[model samples]
Target: MTYSLSDFGSYWAGGEVLCVTEGAPREIAFTRDARFTYDPRGDFAVNAAYVQYFVPAQAVDAPPVLLVHGGGMAGSCWETTPDGRPGWLHRLLDAGRVVHVVDLPERGRAGFAPGHLPGEPILRSMQEAWTLFRFGPAEGFADRTPFAHQQFPVDALEAFARRFVPRWQGTAHLHLAAFLAVLDRTGPALVICHSQGSETAFDAVATNPNRITGLIALEPSAFPDDPAALETCPLVIVQGDHLDSADHWRTRADRWATLADELPDARLIDTAHEVASGGSHMLMMDRHSDQVLEATLGHVRV
Candidate 1:
């Protein structure tokens, strides 16, 4: 059965409206609290990572696809396109594959506490995403000039930006534990990940290759210190344009270059080099996300 956007966002927990404004023009007086550490701050409750598993009614024998978001973002990345269109979450499900979308620990509805989670939130600015995400030139970010044929909806930048969550740097182990738990329940599956979640993907795939059948990393980094183990599982790195400079892609080239030499079995695909229509770093959210999704599905089913 096809899942609706509301169906994906229905899971809720771990917060309350402690105070509300009482006056002619009512406003939120304040919230209960953003921080929820192990040591209770006042009848606090922690939420499980919100995961929506979309399994087609006529299921394929393929392994389930686990969709993980990058830093400063939540599982909503897969829910819908900036332009109010069905995103990869729906596309993959329609392709007859089971897909699991996640809001990892301390993100979205997963719950969080500042000092308690072992690291602080790395707040991101609009310009940071604009430039870093390869939307366009630095000046264009301020002026909102998108690259020619850019897929991301400029109109939805505000909503897209809202999904940015605070990244927890020192909590890979926590993410790993959560991922492992998911795997234990789902059984071995194909793990598709983005930027920061790459770390968790590699670690999980490496430590338990039997549980993680494959990995398709999009503009990913933080590859395991030792990538040799990644060879055990099917691996593919799908990279998009580094329009600004080689700095971003250069570092990635160097890392993957080394991995390629060491493990000739691993594969890499540069979208700009192959596809007639190039994509940005946030390729999956772009207008032609299906092209990249096509490349992703090709390698995963095995």
Candidate 2:
């Protein structure tokens, strides 16, 4: 079920608007006032959804920090708590940093009407569908429980692939543009990206050059390409030792160091050992969140 640009326009014209919520499990807040748009030429043109959280800083002049989540999860994942308490959102807010989190298009409560692209298969599950249709994390990496239970139509996949995937150099640019748009209106800010979200932060720093003050990347995925592109910004890559072996951390640290060595402006702080007690990939939300936060705060400078 391939869709042309016109097909997407027609779909968007009749598509139902839905209110998506973003926050941690402790406090699930709805985007009471949210807007949606489709841009075929832009990132995913399926159109990414933006969710704004206003964190009033004690000092009116504090710069904001854009928190971006990785694939499969929305901004809410950052705040979700096993015991139902405010997650990192409150932590950042408490520390005097204004935070803005977003739900990139196609995921979360964002939806597409049926018959939009009829020829594609109607997926039995959203997770399976996402793995089959979208780029980023492979199927093996998916957390089975979530992927197995959610369902989505294949045309939605077509819309994502046809419109969104082609324009995206990687997941990083989609997020970078979203943050940049916010920064244009707000002001220069720090970028706190988790998992694959770090890719976007790296792209933003590389492309914009000094627009973002610092980046705190939690369990950043592997990027073997040009590490030099990421050398321009002060980056703190946090790796959970429990997720991978010492060799994995060593290799990643060496790569980051190599990249930093080339740029001179870049600095790498490998926190694998620091987060060794944390279970796995989702370290930012794990038991060691305080450590992660402290390490992140130490590097970010604000």
Candidate 3:
């Protein structure tokens, strides 16, 4: 109840803030299908611009795994699949491991900024406008009993990174220049964030620790109050014990397991009993998401 950045851009441009271009795509298909496209007539993009991949079909030379979704859901939640086959982006592309999926910054196809409000739409009990257009827009703000918590007025994420980070300045320097241009074009690799994009993939590997060689934070929501950029990498804190009884997600997983116990190369794999039956923070796309992708490829292949 404290919105004020032009009243949160006029209540996200007066449509009660709901922006979603398109979703539900990954109809199960892997073994290579990349597409990180962009510039969809740019005006702060968002007409489902692009960001989908599913590489796998073995053939090593690993080092390139950036899934990073979670928060309403997109990038088809790592190309969701279970009984139908090929999920976890084809198990990190069979294990050859070179997968990068990102549809962050407000849901998939990533395009929304012409008077805003492309997602975060809610309305469950107001006699249901046909169940809010058949629960579209990412299941209509993911039915939190008719959506109640919407945000995006921290200067509209710095006016959406000065219209998609190309030379934009301010909004924490365009989120540190889009985290150094996605780790200088996807660095050393291995980062698998879910839930709040694990706080921008742990601040893009803690502000570029030589472009990450490891990290698998599945349920992270990035509650930074100077966690030393997640105590400087090598993390593995997966959570789901019912979001650990939500006292601010167990105080940010006990402050990231107390900064991974003073960082002896940090690690905290609390799967919460393999996601105790109902891990619905989209559970990485449910059915225990291959046991959270085999515990995130056995800790990103050691």
Candidate 4:
């Protein structure tokens, strides 16, 4: 299904902008024979990070909410559900938020092309998502039924699978560069990022704490290099369920929990413990997304 990004919110007006970034030249080896043969275009290349604004009919006295998606995903991740239902973008806008959904560099509508990015695209296999997202029994992904309280649109799993973007690994620097560009144009915003996207949000806050008023990380997989700097910004860490079993996320969650304790304005919101229905890693797309949305909005309002 095709979606017009401008119609993301229940707002009076909205628009889209392509944020460009100029950076220092970097060496690139195109082939085995070519050494440090960089593109002659200099540093000013059009980044793929697209930003959209949704202005509400009644303006709320709050910073706009900037929605950033996780790895292997794009700005479309927050636009709609696999089952063709309203998504977080709509929910936030209805709640009186000026929303900005971003397509990070090399992902989504952010002009992703082969050789444009340094690395190969990271494609998520069905099994990888099934196991990593904690949809069902990890042992037998296809055989086991999804959690009875699953918030994800499991019946329309195929649609969800198709939402995955052609994302590149080891491009956090590039993503951050473009993210900073968006932040510059939007002024202070409440950065709501998920998983890998959290890295850019965290770094953006540290880079310039004044640019971001608040930060909400949903199942953050990456962390801040300097927690001391991040502590200045109001931060909310949302950890989804089933993390205790996954070693990869288990340690990361624990580390962030510890880091949160050290920060004055930082707090961790464990969705697993917040609601009886609980939530998976992709809580925003889960069945109880509304509940999680309210939880996040609470922090943003603070």
Number of the predicted model whose TM-score against the real structure is largest: 4
Residue 15, model 4: lDDT of: 22
User: Model 1 residue 295 lDDT?
Assistant: 72
The model with the greatest lDDT is 4
Q: State which candidate, 2 or 4, has the greater lDDT.
A: 4
Q: Candidate 4 regions off by >4 Å?
A: 1-44
Model 3 CA deviation exceeding 4 Å by range: 1-49, 57-66, 69-94, 98-100, 105-109, 118-191, 198-219, 222-250, 253-296, 299-302
In model 3, which range of ten residues has the least summed lDDT?
Answer: 6-15
lDDT, candidates in the order shown: 0.73, 0.51, 0.49, 0.76
Better of 3 and 4 by TM-score: 4
Model 2 alpha-carbon drift over 4 Å, by segment: 1-46, 109-176, 222-226, 243-257, 260-272
Task: List the pairs of residues colliding in candidate 4.
Answer: 48-110, 151-286, 151-287, 152-286, 152-287
| Model 2 C-alpha lDDT per residue in residues 89-179, reported as the tens digit of each score | 6677666667776555443433322222224322234444344322123443344322221221222333322222211223344355655
Clashes of each: 3, 9, 12, 5
lDDT of 1 at 204: 83
Cα-based TM-score, every candidate:
0.82, 0.59, 0.26, 0.83
lDDT preference between candidates 1 and 4, better one: 4
Deviation in Å, model 2, residue 68 alpha carbon = 0.5
lDDT of 3 by residue, 145-235 (tens): 3222211122122222222221111222323344345556655777777655666666666667668777877656664445666554677
Give candidate 2's error at residue 207 in angstroms: 2.0
RMSD of 4: 7.5
